[model samples]
Target: MKSYHLIKKKKNYNHKFLNTTFCDKDKIRQAFPFTALIGQTNMKLALILNVIDPRIGGVMSMGDRGTGKSTVVRSLVDLLPEIQVVNEDPFNSHPNNFDLMSQNVKELKKKGDKIYTNFIKTPMVDLPLGATEDRVCGTIDIEKALLDGTKAFEPGLLAKANRGILYVDEVNLLDDHLVDILLDSAAGGWNTVEREGVSIVHPARFILIGSGNPEEGELRPQLLDRFGMHVRIKTIKDPISRVKIVERRSQFDRFASNFLIEYQYLQDFLKNRIINARGSLKEIKIDYQYKVNIAELCSNLNIDGLRGDIVTNRAVKAFVALNSRKSVIDKDIFTVISLSLIHRLKKNPLESIDSNQNIIKTFKSIFGYS
Candidate 1:
């Protein structure tokens, strides 16, 4: 088993894979397996759906720390199949996916050469809290210009994360300015750079996954709204369940070298399910009743905007697709509504609130959830 650590320098760092082959075997073993994690079904489901449908904005995991928040994210890479990426493309955009690599194509055409295509696996890049604007957004290559008198644009994390996951651990602690950058890029699915006499734009679309302890600080409402799904995870309280979690984790760490091989089938199963679900998602139909129910729920809960309704609808559709269901049902709607709406419902400090339970009960009564 090997230990994996992200080594960062001024504007560059070693690119290492947690589960991939590296000289240090112990680092890879240090990563907890996603399959061994217990409970937190909502968190797991949110992550799974986001992988299947990156269109669902991204997932936010808010809870106390040391509850395996980061572990679940790292382990997800093991579950996802490697994605094809363009070789030598700074942004790592898949050459085959022209829609996502349009900007790259334009740049290549300007250079008077036909762009060739190559494939690479999807990567999960972490955005550390202390990262600077230059590091995150890329900066001019002064040395390259000094040596060749030609401007060179260095790609940033956003570029590297293209067509992959951009994970921000303890995201609430990140600077507001950085958050704004992320929000703008994520909203548009592209990052445009026009500073330092360099104008460059490339595909920056990615699945934004964030985790933090809400007790430390509440995420800004504006940023909070950006997340398509919010899941609250807490340490399992049942002694038996807790013990089982510890045992499984211990066994995985003890046999880190063989852990992935043993669970390779299970990982492939989950990956295939996600891939198939994405295709099937387009076929799931939402009835007028479901729409009305969603709208009514939002209105009843006094949710701020139409985004909630949209996310709730998409989540229900994805949930049904995951289960291979052809149509959205009352139960599916109820479950999504609960998962998507509960975290957003505002609480009144003056009044004692049990809104979560109340909403669930009301939804059950309205939708006849058994």
Candidate 2:
């Protein structure tokens, strides 16, 4: 068995073992398996739900350093189902969906040209902290357009991230303007760039994943609420669990090939679940009463906007689909309601109640939990 070493042998106990590099599908197999992660169940659940249904918007994870936040996100790459894209298209244009294809590809298809496509690993694009607006949103080359009599548009991170995941580490530290741009594109599923009075538009649909430490600086409530789900991750306090995590990391480091093989079955199982869930999402049903209860729960919590209710519904359905179920159950809502509604609550610095606990309490009151 061939080995895939993600980290150097030179030991730094405190360093993050997994590097969050965007690579080809073959290299993605070397990542730490998503199923092998030790803890942070909420974070994992949120990520999986988003994967099942990208319309759940995206997930924001805030936690302590070295809590495997980035590792978890990158590991998700291994489970991502490959997508068919037009050959040589920077936007990763979908083969059949005109809405997802670039303008040139659309014209080619309209002209009865055979649009060549190949299946490739779904993209996982990282937005660097130092990236400029043009780099992220792409730029239009006015000089080329003037000389060649064409719209010379350059694709950016958002273009590459179409039909994929866009992850930003330390997102709280990112520029507010850039953060606004990201959120806007995420919500609208399109990014439009204007340069020198020339404009270009492309599909920017992707699951926007952002992770950060709360201590660094919090995202403005308005911005945070835009994310469909928020998970709070804490460092593991249990001594035994900590030991298990360390042992697993050490084993993988020493015997990378064997470790991957050990978890190969679980990885495949998860990948298949994701693919099946996506295909069956339209078949999953949620009861009308559950929607009412969800609305009531959000109302009692004083969550701003209908986004909370909408995200909660989508997340619960995605959770059901992930379990290979045909309908939503009360317990399914319980599993995801907190993730969807907690961040939408109005900040009350004087309030002593924990946000998660508050949501749970409200849920029990409205939904009749013991």
Candidate 3:
């Protein structure tokens, strides 16, 4: 059987990978299957939860290099369903969206020529270390203004990345000013650009994914709290697991097609689960006792604000949805509470204990081991 991870089947094509790229790109970039990664279970779970529900806030992964952090984030691009966008529109605007789409798009639709659409692969763009404000927020088209005597807006990374993932590597090292912009857009789901007294606003709702080594630098508390969940990664400690990791990478390097074929079934299973979970999220049950349990845990941990309780609710629900279940249970909350609340807890100056350990202790105190 053909590997679904490698190329787009005829059934799923829309002929607009980048909307204006030379041709399809699914064949060019070969991402490792999400189901095939070794270890780092918590980190992988955090990524999957965010994919299932972006409102849980995007996840942050901080750990050592060569732990498959970037690989995991990029692999997620493969598992997402294609998004609909107005054809020939650079911003990838949703249909019938005049307020956020370009004026050209609005005019084209007004002419009633049966506006076409393309179901393109969702984007997963990188936020480079040296990206400028205009580069991230877009800028005014100076040459168009000077020559055509008309104003044009140049879409940037954020524009290309609407309804997609904005991954920032070494996130702790990103400039603080840019961090502020990320926080604002992440919270508001809109990116407004003002330059030369001209302003532009468009949909910028994307999951903010960042991976870095904390030893390089510390993430600001303000920004840290903004992440829906955070997890630490480490190299495999078991000798067999390490050897298997090497074997898998070697197989992928030497025979990518075969490697993908080996895991295509597993990948398809995960992809379907995510798709179904999204459709059923509204109907998934949320018990009040579960809410009290999450609130109690966050409160006892001294995690400030209601963000913890809020994120925990979303995460737990997604967790249940991921398991193909329709309701929340005490054990379901246990599975996600640490990931949701650990990053939100206030840190003590002299405490070396990790937040997950503290969360486990609290879990035992409240619900006892499960």
- Model 1, range 56-100, lDDT digits (tens) per residue? 788889998789888888888866667766557777766556657
Writing each residue's lDDT as its tens digit, candidate 3 over 1-370 gives 4777446664245455355343323433588888989888998899888888888889889998888899889888778988888887777777776645655677677887678888998778899999999899999887777789777888888888887889999999999999889878877888888766667777787899998998899898878999999988887789999999899988887777778888899988888989898887877879887777778888889888999989999998888888889978778888888888877888898888877888998987877564
Q: Judged by lDDT against the true structure, how good is candidate 2?
A: 0.91
Q: Measured by C-alpha RMSD in angstroms, how accurate is candidate 1?
A: 7.3
RMSD of each: 7.3, 7.3, 7.6
Model 3 clash pairs? Answer: none
| Model 2 C-alpha RMSD to native | 7.3
- Comparing 1 with 3 on lDDT, the higher-scoring candidate is 3
Number of the top lDDT candidate:
2
lDDT of each: 0.79, 0.91, 0.83
Candidate 2 per-residue lDDT, tens place, 238-340, comes to 9999999999988877776778889999999999999999999999888899999998998899887899999999999899999999988889999999999
lDDT of the structure predicted as candidate 3: 0.83
lDDT order, best first, reads 2, 3, 1
User: Please, what is the TM-score per model?
Assistant: 0.86, 0.92, 0.87
**Model 3 lDDT, residue 121, Cα:** 82
Q: Candidate 1 — number of clashing residue pairs?
A: 15
TM-score of 3: 0.87
Worst 10 residues of 2 by lDDT: 16-25
Clashes of each: 15, 0, 0
